[model samples]
Target: MIKDLFLSGKTAIVTGGGGGIGRAIALGLSHAGANVLVNDLGVSVSGDSEARNPADTVVEEIEAQGGRASANHGSVAEAKATEKMVEQALDTFGSIDIVINNAGIIRMGEFPQMSRSDWEAVLRVNLQGSFYLSRAAAPHFRAQAGGAYLHLTSASGLIGSTSQANYAASKLGIVGLSRAIALDLGQHGVRSNCLAPSSTSRMTELTDNARKHLMSPEKYEALKRMRAASAPERIVPLIAYLVSDRARGINGQVFGARGNEIYLYGQHRPVRMMHAAEGWTPAQADERLPAGLGAFATPLEVITDVFTWPPA
Candidate 1:
């Protein structure tokens, strides 16, 4: 049997807690003794609001399990709504000790074909939404002298994916935002970390080909072999740890969590720097370009080399 981390008096607000990995984490946190605020817009994958019962359903599940929880329906993309959601948590629970910024949306289209509106729409929800929530919660965390901030990122942020420039950009933006917040909030006792989770959620459900690529045939077979396996629940333990007192010293780090597999993401590797010294002219550059490019030659090589191609 697992020992309880003992969070009987703590309160948590999990944005996007209505379903998928967010719901799993909220359930785990509530099971550990925290009263939770479940905030979700019930938005579709494309950022359109659809279901109204998802957040309510999560709350009901928590209550049925004898865990305290309240539901809030608001788009994290809007600053006013985000603030109101945080306020609702404080009003209902009296204090906010943990926040999981899991609210996000995806707009996928190939570059040169993707509309500016689509790009902005993805950023509005995935990146700006997290910022708005964090901004609202920072003061509360500071006053309490401690809190946990968990942002949901993706493997696409750490690597490249085809036709997902906007999605990748937004996700990568969260990593930088989390790092900055960690640096600024550490002195105030606030811990900020990000999770790049590989779950078979609605987000993944939309892209079947992408799902196949993410899970190798062997890995998929192994997953099928396990009884009662759900990728959503598998990521919860790491989240629980990050929010627990045991992870007090861990901040500004990115973790990759999948079914029964947790790994640290984003360790800076050595880079080969090239410089055009000795007054190298354009002609010289072109002449020696093949050898200069070395193993990094070709457009496909460029695409495969960097996590975000043609960096913005």
Candidate 2:
């Protein structure tokens, strides 16, 4: 099923396709019979400007395998650059059917110690970039009556994070964005979904701050095991599948992939309900709410706490 060519005749724009999971998804999508536009700024995971643009290398690899592909060296942080990406895809492939928001950067800081610039920088690329790409393609998608968006979010966004406040905020913001897009555009046959993937990539590398302050010995060891067991390739197939025609019925949901395991994230809903028939004052409200509802409150869990065992 993973090797099915269900995406034949589609065109996909894969941002951050230079390396890691982004590269893997681009290659996989192309092999599924889609024309791919591999876009990468060639900057490090930190989002610094660099001399090289690695998009071309991935394009070369796709071409070597007898696939149709092109390269774009634009930064997703800029709206105009993302617009140009859509233009390039349309010019080369005739139409854009899929947009993969895989380009993101992480800056480490605890809540109190986080700098404003660091927070804004991460959101600019990770959250706003997703907006730019999706917005740029939306008109075309509307005109064509169909399209798909696959945003690569993270467990840090869904669950609690370990001193990655900026990164977590951006990733969680993406979930909200995806839900909005799915609701606003689903009538037009457009679909939007989020993939919270675990992988051994540059973003997953443990930071020194986390090493020193954020973790106990147990958590530190657990994180190391997670990074070692999850590979970027294992997360790619689900991403590719989410943006293909085969997944047309699925929309507005968050899914996860780690190792060979895939699972759905529970969306928010009320777990308990309490009614005060007498319309109690503030004093009585406190007495009834906590005693009745506190027991049902969800525990604060990190990715590791929920996934106690290593994935196969």
Candidate 3:
């Protein structure tokens, strides 16, 4: 049945294809019949320059399996570099049918002590990089009559996390950017969506370590069990489906992946309301809120709750 979702003759560019989720998706796309342009600067998690070329390894793996691919060593954080990445895909594959913005960096610090540089650095690579790549590839999508843009967000953004203010901000910004793109390019036959995957990767591993130290033994074990349920391959099918004709009817939505489970998130809307002919005094408002608005308030759902087993 997966072959029915084939992307034969289509060309796709996957940013951050060097390793982890990006690498898995790149290979998955290739297996589905898309010619891939694997772009990775081969940098470390913090964006430090490295001499190796991880992109080449992805290209080789695809080629070894009888798929077409090319490698690009460029940082998505820069506008010019991302532009060149698009050019490279066009030159090698002759067309760009899908663009997945998966390149990102994570810098964690407690909110109050978070440095200006740390915040800027995370935004530069995670938020700015997605913007640059999507902007550079939009015109091409328009010219082609149709395309798909899949940006990787995070559970941190969807829910909340501690000591990850910068990461959460960037991820949430990505979702906002994606929604706007979906609206702006819909008439042009372009589809844009955001994915909040719960897969284990370098990012999740780091968060797990932090939780281990911050949580009680039983709570940490529960966290560990939930993480064990997550793996990169569990989310790849969603990526494949999104970029296929099968998903043409879906756009501008945020979906989550955990093990074999796929979940949809509803848009934020007011759950309770209060009104007055004019306005109320602060004291009056405070007194009315608890009986009215506060009565409907619910606790924020934790990760364990979201990914819990036995289906509720």
Candidate 4:
């Protein structure tokens, strides 16, 4: 059982722990013996309107299961709010050992038609939000000499997804942020990593009736197949393991969870290096570069194109 994994005497702050994937991770962390501070803004997936406190419900569920948890309704988009989140976790659980930068909002739009407001909104919650919480936790982790950071990434950016350039950009930026954090804080014994989850979610906008008319029948049906086979619960095991002592040696990595399959993702590298020993004019370079690099050029493929087989 994942709950049997070792995480005793530790505290975790799960941002956006109100619902969906965030809620699942929070519960998983609690079951694994970590005191969880459930932080959420209680806003809709689109980052609009607050309702009743979503964090409280998760806290109640955790308590009912004989686990320790606290409710924190703070937006990670603000630095001050995230700072308060770290303080809340310390006050509630004593010492922080895990930080899950899972709180996020999506504003999907294609590049040409994407709005400035929409782009900013997506970046604020997905990229800046992760930065804020991680930044606030840095000093504490440094002092303690041991901490783990996991930020949620997405195929939308890691690979590609149609009509979601704004969302993709933010998610991809998170990959960079996680790597930088891992590098700077490794000396302090803080580990930072990223998880790209393939699961069904309330944010699955392809189900919208209006959008259904915009996509081809085959394309829409394909997306449905990919999401249907994957569940939010399937992601819990990997997360539980990553935050536990068992994964102490694992740091500065990107991982993925899809149904029963877990993946270690590869980072960017030079596929083929071209050193122009002597500089050439634009016309000369254009003539030779494409000829030399054409075979190695990456195809413009979406996530679905690559993960053609659904996880069983």
- Residues 1-312, model 3: lDDT tens digits: 244337888899999999889998899999889999999989877677778789999999999988999999988889999999999888998998899999988877789999999999999999999999999999999987799999999888778778888999999999999999999998899999999887767777877787667677877776767667777877888898898877888989998877788888776778988887778989888888788887688667656555546211
The reply for model 4, stretches above 4 Å from the true place, is 205-216
Model 2 C-alpha lDDT versus the unseen true structure: 0.88
TM-score of 1: 0.84
Clashes of 1: 0
**Weakest ten-residue segment in model 1 by summed lDDT:** 303-312
TM-score of each: 0.84, 0.94, 0.95, 0.95
Candidate 2 ranges beyond 4 A from true positions = 1-3, 207-209, 216-218, 278-280
lDDT of 1 by residue, 32-134 (tens): 8899999888888887878465989999999998889999988888899988988888898898889899988787777989999999999998999999999
RMSD (Cα, Å) of model 1? 5.3
Highest lDDT scorer? 2
Q: lDDT per prediction?
A: 0.81, 0.88, 0.86, 0.86
Q: How accurate is candidate 4 locally (lDDT)?
A: 0.86
TM-score of 3: 0.95
Clashing residue pairs in candidate 4 are none
